[model samples]
Target: MNGCAAFCSPASTQPALPLTLAHPLAHHSCTMFFKILLLSAAAFSATTTAATTYKASFTQYGSTDTWGSGNCNVASTACGFYTSPGYSAAVSQNEFGVGPGAGAGPACGTCWKLTAQTDSSGNNLSNAGNSIVVQVTNLCPASGNPLCAQKGLTGTNQYGANLNFDLCIDSGASNALFGNSGVGLAVGSAVQVDCNQWSGEVVH
Candidate 1:
């Protein structure tokens, strides 16, 4: 027989070849994996959009001793596991939408960016263009106290609206951010603030 004839075989005598199909379990797992990925992305988007911006005012808190154990009242411990410097603040219990000594206030340990400080007359102060960052370390602006109102805060109650921040004078934050004027944060000084739930923590 010729070489080509010898190498050829009848269709019926051809060797059998194995076939493989995708496993049902594997297919299911792959679909589930992709579903989880999409769900996580959606959750992250929601968190990013949750940051809120609102009008607020500022005042000076007394000595650092008022920090109550040095930990935020909400956390009940020094810095409440936070190790960053200047991580101190006093948020209005009412305005922040939480009860006093609740230790569950969302504003606790939150970071705030304060700027555009102006007097009751709406005239910007010397540090009008400057901004300062501080952390929430205490609860303040007690209801019906007029803490901000007495300090020259005009208009509605800052505590009622959760729009007040009583920064610690010992932190030197007043002079650093509001200028070294003989008076640190003159009473009734108005300021605009931006607060975020996660901006206060520092790794270093």
Candidate 2:
């Protein structure tokens, strides 16, 4: 009749509860889950470590105009993806990894994942987390911008970025990368990825 006796037999003896053993398949599944988690963590760490951080800004060029006059005129782009309809960027000389007057730089046609972090004013941007992949089609000469100078001596930009990326506003991913303004500087990080990762035409 008491709380303990209610559940016990009339003799007030307590019965032992049955013990259930875990199935072999459950152990296997748990091990697999942990293995997958470790692999995913490693992949994320590798991606973060492999990315070369850079400062991002914007440039303007005709997307389809070949006869336009400018360093990055579509037809005269370093990588020759002039008419390609997709994101494009002008990387600084240090990051571009090419010498003066080189027809096509070593960094040309490389794909980069650019994620904005802040605007020229150093304020965190609402679209800061958005990222867009772009193909390198032009060079932002170190002579033109100190931020583009060779490493070691180039130093960081006004926004404190080691490298500078002058993105083209007319590129296909402009809205996604730069938002509506699309005309000012944006601080961001850059990662060189496989060109195949680009969703646009990649002509090297």
Candidate 2 regions exceeding 4 Å error are 1-49, 54-73, 150-154, 181-183
How far is 168's C-alpha from truth in model 1 (Å)?
1.1
Best by TM-score: 2
Report the C-alpha lDDT of model 1 over 1-204, residue by residue, as the tens digit: 332233332234654222223345544565666688789999998887565554566666544444353423233422343324453556555544455545545555566666545654456676565667776665664556564332322334633323566665555555555575333433232232344532444332
Pairs with steric clashes in candidate 1: 71-77, 71-78, 71-79, 89-137, 95-162, 151-187, 151-188, 152-188
TM-score of each predicted structure versus truth: 0.52, 0.63
Top lDDT: which candidate number? Answer: 2
Per-residue alpha-carbon lDDT of candidate 2 for residues 1-204, written as tens digits (9 for 90 to 100): 332223332332455332224345544565666688789999999977585555555433444334463434365676566525678887877777775688678888788888887777878777777788888888778775665764642467656776677666566555667686443567777778877778776544
- C-alpha lDDT values of all predictions: 0.50, 0.66
